[model samples]
Target: MGAEENIGGVAAILRPVAAVIVSVSPSGCVELRLPSRRRSWRCDGVGSAMWIALRQHDGRIGEASEMLAGIWRLDPVDVRCVMNSWAAELCDAGFLRLEK
Candidate 1:
């Protein structure tokens, strides 16, 4: 299965690799870096919130999506889709790993 197929699900557990460096700005902007790959990604606003939520929720995708959905007044399913897509993209980029 593709990365998306493997990761874009609410049950998936997502975690950044050991070498990942995460920086959060006072404005809620999040920066993720993988020194080994010389790769970085910036997440602002809602994306930042999602990242924080995932971390706070211990990588539980369902919890993260539900938290975001409540904050944004959106459907939990829609938030899950977005979260899963984002996580899958990060996984494909080698920034994150999926745990069974």
Candidate 2:
């Protein structure tokens, strides 16, 4: 399936790869590094919340977004959009995977 199809809906399962290291700063910023690739991504604001929620929930996409939405008092629609966009990027970078 295409990458977007892979994460087509709320039912899609997402799991973080062991190779990527996700760090959350006290200020609620997020940083992710792929040690093997020697590359990193930094996320602030909403992105950081999404990152931390993913980590805390073992990369379950739907649950992570729900938790983050309630925590941040945001619309679920917005949360899902952020999750989908971030998931696409992380998947493209090989830091995350979609399980059928």
Candidate 1, 1-100: lDDT as tens digits? 2323344553457888889999987877999999888999998787788889999988787888888899899999888898888887777888778785
Runs in model 1 deviating more than 4 A are 1-11
Residue pairs with backbone overlap in model 2: none
Please give the TM-score that candidate 2 achieves against the real structure.
0.74
Clashing pairs in 1: none
Cα lDDT for residue 49, candidate 2: 73
For model 2, the superposed segments whose C-alpha errors exceed 4 Å read 1-11
lDDT of candidate 2 over 1-100, digit per residue (tens): 2323344463456777778887877887888889899988888787777777887887676678888889879997688777888888888888788776
RMSD after CA superposition, every candidate = 3.4, 3.4
Query: Where is model 2 poorest over a 10-residue stretch in terms of lDDT?
Result: 1-10
Q: Best TM-score goes to which candidate?
A: 1
